[model samples]
Target: MNIAIISPGPFSVPPVNGSSVEHDIDEVTKMIDPEHQVTIYTRKCATYPKSSVEENREFIRYAYKGPTPYLQKIIKHIRKHKPDVILVENRPTYVLALKRHFPKIPVFVNMHSHVYGSTAMISKAKMKKVVRLASGFITNSEFLRRHFMRTNHIPGHKIHAVHLGVDVSPYQEAKLHSSIKKLRKQIGLKEDHRILFYAGRLMRGKGVHVLLKAFRHVSEKDPLARLVIVGGTGYGSNRLNPYVKELKRLSEPLGNKVKFVNFVPSVKMPLYYQLGDIVATPSVWKEAFCRVNLEAMASGKPVISTPRGGIKEVVTHQGSGFIIPPKEWSKELPIIWELLWSAPHIRTEMGKQALMRAKQFSWYATAQGYLKVFENAVAKREAGKQPLQKTG
Candidate 1:
């Protein structure tokens, strides 16, 4: 089958920097059946050429003149390629346009999150039209699926929850352990110190402040414990924004206990994970799904995350990692952090379980699942059957 993927305009295909959705798209497209051809439509970037074909897939970058012209170029490409299945990512507004202009093509909207920059300003009427036209909706987690269903008043059958996956080989225990010493040395971390890592955007919604607050309490109890924060202000931002500045202010009294590192490339993430004894993902907002938690688990490290959105589905309490409610992070996070900090045996056991759990979620498996969904949608479309209509 020929597949066309429409990536959001902000990010590039194959994700030179850190884009979880784009990375997933890249992984899944590469792992799809060799016989199938995949083409990704993404915004033009200096990092990538206008059009390139490699890894059994083609990437075409569209210029960002404006929404109308930008989408026109994409429509032209879609018409030229005439893919069997169209996978639109996140932007419902674009899906609306695609469905209106090219109704015969089976289009599936892969919603990465409940909110999208492109569809934020779109009216509810237009959104309903988009939902009605798309063959089906795909969410990364059950939590997101349920949330989308409830919030959008869409039927459960119309949406499918296919969990995002990590490439577990690089994060295998042996590989992670092999690089730990050198990674620690490079970051000026002492061998004896226990590191707690947070490796995503340094923003308030990500609960970096909450993590810092909890870390302060943990540091007071365990003098050897250190917190290492990775990443800059959200995606695409290269500077230490106000949020990072506030985090620095919050970490002032903690002194050497808190270390803030600038953004690390996605490829180098395993080294950072290897340097840490525990991973903390204290996102206060409802994260549709967090790839950081999966990556950490794949690296054989226990994660301490909030039970927000689909996080509980990933991090089970006392199974792979511990999940504390966001509201109770101040009271609960430090205690859990202390527990993992004090007991190396427990942490080691949980780390093993984490690695095992991580194995269950693989990019190849996710790709296969998506293929099944795509085939079903195409078959239904060809049969002149209407999509599963949304009913309250």
Candidate 2:
């Protein structure tokens, strides 16, 4: 099968430290390439290092620079390639572009999350219309799928739920000693201190402020605990928000215990995950899914996440990690403290269990899910065009 994946994001396979959407695109393409031809389309935001390079299997990249007729350019490429299936990552702009340009091309959209909740890209009404136009819709979690149906009136049959994939093989029963020492030395981590890690974009919906508040509670109990936040470039208009500021303030009392690193590439992320004893994601908004949680789990680290959207699917209360009730950090803090104080052994056991569970989710599974969607899209397209026969 020949497949084309379109993304409105800044890069085609993500430069390094990119969003979960970019990571998903990369993983899916790599997984499917062995059995199928795959190509990725991304916005020409800036100059890439190379025009094209074949890394693994059969994968190709087409990037355009500047903002000159992007939709027209994409359409031209589609016409030239005549791919068997086109999978467009669900961004509001791409939805409109596909609706206008690739109407009959059997476009399958991978809906990352509900637009009504946290993503400030499209409004409720617009999102509904986009879902209606898609030939097939996919979401990472059932929560997002239900949100789409409830808000957009989309039928249940129209949506496919495929949870995000992870590579558990590389991390299965792996030693963290080397990775830990490297990351610790790089980030100035202390030998005796226990590290609590948070990985994701330092944005509003990620709940950086909530993390700080909870950190304060955690620090009150274990003063030596260190929180390492990784991501954000600290560049231009998307500068530090109020949440980042609030975190700085909250961490002040704890002195140098809180540390923030901007823009750690995805290649180096596994090390950070290895160094962490626990991973925390306190996102306040409804996330489509959190890829960081999967990485952490695969690295044999227990996770602590607020019950929100797709996060619940990845975290289980006292199973993989603690899934606290929404907005209940005050009640949740003690649980975090108990784990920090009494259960170092449980942390090791749970970390191993987390890695084992993470194995069930893999990129091959993600590719298989998309391939099914593509097959369905082609079948549906053919069925719609079949001429009606007169009844005898």
Candidate 3:
């Protein structure tokens, strides 16, 4: 089977660290069944050739001015070497355009977030039409599967929710004493300090402000506790946005106890995950999934996250980590902090369990899920063609 994966235009493949969509694209393609030839289309990155086959996967990068130009760049490439199946990541409208151009091929749209399919971004009628044209709608979590079905009115069979995977080996590897110590020294972490890490976009939805508020209380009680906030407003964005100002204000009393690290790419995330003795996502959004929980688990750290969206799927309350109810995070954090600090052995045991759980969610499993979606979608679409076409 020949497969073509089209990443959104904003980022390049092999991920520049800021784009989780690109990172998923890069990881999935690497673990794809080698018998099938894989081609990836992404926006241009200066470091890589426009067209190059590295490790058996072909990457085609085009200079992108905007989404329209970038889609055209992909169209020109597809006209020449059309694949058996095409996977569109992030943009729902891309599926519509691809279906219009290549009526026979199976085009699957994989949604990383709820932002695209929501009526806020596109009209409900247009979203339904996009769903009608595409072979399958894939989401990063089952929660999102129900979302599109309700919002876009897509049939249950046409949508699949495949959980994203993490390359745990990097996080696992970074646990070596010297490597972790060097990272700690660089961050100015004290030997006795217990780090509380928060990584993700520094915005309202990610609960950055909520994290600061919770940490201010955590710091006042436990002098050894340190809060490390990772990520900028967006990928590579360093400007202090308004929410960041609010977060700074919240952290004022804690002062040096709170550390806001700038945005680091996906490559450095492994070590950063290790920076936390215990990680806290503390998200308030009903996001499709939080890769932070997965990465933190992979690094053998317990996470304190809300039971929102797919986070409930990855985090087990008092098993691998704690999944606090959204309404209870404020009341619960102080209690959970006391428990973890008093019984440090639970942290070690939970870390072991977290790593074991993290091992189950591998990039190889992610690829297999996509491959299964490809096979089933192709078979279903082909079966629906010709005599069954009009009804479909």
Candidate 4:
């Protein structure tokens, strides 16, 4: 089968660090059956050229001079390729356009988060229309699937929950001691220090401030504990962003115990995970799914995250790690951190369980799940069944 995947205009396929949605698209496309042809339509960034073919898949990029013109380029390519199915990611407006222009073609809309959130690039009304028009909907987690169904008034059957995948090999517990020692020495971390790792955007809603507050309490209890923040404002920015400045100000009294490493490349992320004794994601807002948590778990480290969105689905409380409720992070996080800090044996056992759980979610399995959804949508379209419409 021939497939065409449409990505958001801001990033390219196989993103460097962030861009989870783009990363998922790239992984699914690459890992899918080689017999099936896949082409990804994304913006032409400095790293990716206009057209490149590799790993039995193709990437076609467009320069975003303007929305209308760029979309026109996309439509032209879609017409030329004439794919069997179309997969659109996170761009509801473009989904609407694709469905309108190619009414007979099956277009699957992949929702990475709530359509009404601040990160949504399209309007609610347009998103509703896209939901009604698209052949099917795909979400990264059951939490998002339920949220979309409730908010958009769409039926549960029309949406599928396919968890995102991670490459767990790099994160495996091999050369653990050597990697830890090397990273600790390079980063000027002491051997006795307990590192709390947080890797992602330094945004307020991500609950970096909450992590700081919790870390302060933990530091007071365990003088050897340290917080290492690894990220920038967002994708592509490696400097001290406004949020980083705020975090730095919040950690002022804590001194060098709170270390900030700006924007590590995705390839080098496993090293940071190896350096961490525990991974903490104290996001106040709902995370559709966090890849950081999975990466940390795959590295044989227990994660301490909030029970927000689909996070609970990933981090099993008292098993892989503790899921502290967002409201009680100030009191609960430090307690959990202290417990895990005191008992290295418990951490080791949980880390093993975390690695085992991480194995269940692989890019290969994720691609196969997506393939099943795509095939079903295409079959429905061929049988003259209109896309599921939103019911009143």
Candidate 5:
């Protein structure tokens, strides 16, 4: 089967920087390649030069750096390819554009989250309608599926929970002591200093500021603890929020104890994970599905996430890691600190458990599940039968 995936995210292919969604695309393509042909459609902002067409590992990438009017060109390209099924990843803008002009093809809208915080640019009703018109729907977690049925008014049958995939091969235990020691030296981290790592957009909705506040509280107790933040200013947009600025200001009092590395490539993330004693996904809102937590778990690092979205589903209390409510970081941090300081062996044991749990969610399984959905859409269309539809 030939498939076309459209995403407004600038890096549709293997994004040079690092993106969980792009990582998903890469892993999924690798798994489905021998049996299917896949093409990815990505957007490029005006300021940056567009990357040339490159094909590797059985997938081709097409980039659009032109103005908004070039969407017609996207439709034309899709029409020419005549793919078996079209999958659009997020971005209600593309959904509105395609639904308005090109609704003839069987398009599936894959929604990763129903987060209504900063990026919830579209109305819930409209998003639900887009899902209704599509051949089928794919979501990252049951939390999002329930949000669709209850809030977006979509039917249960139309929605499928296919959690995002993570690569666990890198974290497989083989005595990575040398690699860990190298990273510690590069980061100026001492042997006794426990590393607490956070990676994601340094934005408010991501709860970075809140995490900073909690880290300060943790610092009061454990001065040797280091907080390492990894993420960029977010895709060429320098528009800084006050909370982000405050985070920068707050990092100062800690001196060199707190480190912020703007952005690291996805390929190099394993080293950072290896350096971290514990990984945190402190999302303010219910994250639709956080790949960061999965990556930490894959790296054999215990995760500390909020009781939001599918985070609790991914990390169990005292098992893979701990799941505390968003504002309860005060209540949670001490316990995490205690785990890191008092129970080093227990943390290592938990990290081992996390790696084992991470393997259960593989790109191969996710890609095969996606293939089944695309095949069903094509089969239904070929049978001259309309997919059964339901509205909230």
Candidate 6:
């Protein structure tokens, strides 16, 4: 089978500094069976060349920066070597275009956010056209799958929920004493400091503000606790925006109790994960799926997140981590932080369980799930059967 993947057109593959969706594309391609010739498409970046291959996969990057040119590049390539099935990441409109260009080919549009499924980004009439044309819809989590169905009036059978994965080996490597010591010295942290980590877009919707608000009480209660917030407003974004500026102002009273690490390359994230004694992902809005949970869990650190979207599905509350409701973070955050901070043994045991849980969600598993979907969609199309009819 020849599998062709289209990136959202902004991020480069190998996920040098892109979103988790790109990272998913990279890892899933690497783990996909060697028998299939996987072809990846993404916008070109200085960090990566025009074309490259890793194992059984091949990358054909476009120098064009935006969506239209990116689609043209993909169309040109597909005309040359058409795929068995087409998978477009995080772009619902691309589904309509691909289906229009090659009506016979099966195209699956992946949904990574509520914004994409809702009428906010795409009109209802256009979404109906997408539903009528698309072979299938893929979501990062079952919660997202269900939410999309409700919002878009999509039938359950037309969509599949394939959870994102974490490559645990890299995070496990960060646990080495030498690596830990090196990172500790680099970050100017003492051995006794209880590092609390938060990574994702530094926006209000991501709940960074909520984390900062809760951390004020946490900092006053625990002197040894240090909060380290990671990421910028967007991918490779450096300049602090208003939200980040507010975060800075909020942290002023806490002084050095809080540290903000602006967006670093996706590859170097594990080192920051290693520095955390505990991880916080308190998303105020519905998160389709947050890969940071898996990354933190793989780092052998217990996660502290809210029960928003697919988060509760990923984190085993009190066993692997704590999933307090967003409403209760004000009271629960400090207590949970105190509990984990007071007992190293509790942290160790939960961390072990967390690592065990993380192992189940490997890239290999994610690849297998996607491969099955692609094969089925392709097989169904090849049989000369009509595409799935629009369901509401």
- For all predicted structures, in order, the TM-scores are 0.93, 0.87, 0.95, 0.93, 0.86, 0.94
* Candidate 4: residue 388 lDDT (0-100): 67
Once fitted onto the true fold, the runs of candidate 2 whose alpha carbons sit more than 4 angstroms away are 33-35, 44-68, 95-102, 116-120, 123-129, 170-179, 233-238, 383-392
- Angstrom error of the Cα, residue 366, model 4: value is 1.0
In candidate 3, list every pair of residues with a backbone clash: 17-266
**Per-residue lDDT for 16 in model 1?**
78
Local distance difference test, candidate 3: 0.86
lDDT of 6 at 305: 91
Q: 4 or 6, which is superior by TM-score?
A: 6
Question: How high a TM-score does candidate 1 get?
Answer: 0.93
List candidate 3 stretches off by more than 4 Å: 177-179, 381-392
The deviation in Å at residue 149 for candidate 6 is 0.9
lDDT string for model 5 (178-235, tens) is 6777767777889988889998888877787777778887888888889998886674
Could you give candidate 3's per-residue lDDT for residues 1-392 as a string of tens digits?
Answer: 88988888888887765688888888888898889889999988877788889776999999889888899889888989989899898888888778878988999899999997777877877888888888888888999899888878889998998888988888888777467777777787888998999998888888877777777777778899999988898888877878888888888888789888899987888878878889998788897889989999999999899888888888888999998876676678888888998998998999999998888888888889899989887777667774844653
Go through the candidates in order and give the C-alpha RMSD of each one to the true structure.
4.2, 3.3, 2.9, 4.2, 4.9, 3.9
Model 3 is weakest, by summed lDDT over 10 consecutive residues, at 383-392
Pairs that collide in candidate 1 are none
Name the better of 4 and 5 by TM-score: 4
> Candidate 5: global Cα-lDDT?
0.74
Candidate 1 lDDT score relative to the true structure: 0.84
For 33-128, candidate 4 gives per-residue lDDT tens digits of: 988899888888787677999967998989977667778899998887799899888766777678777888888888888743222566677667
Give the winner by TM-score: 3
Candidate 5 residue pairs in backbone clash: 153-392, 231-262
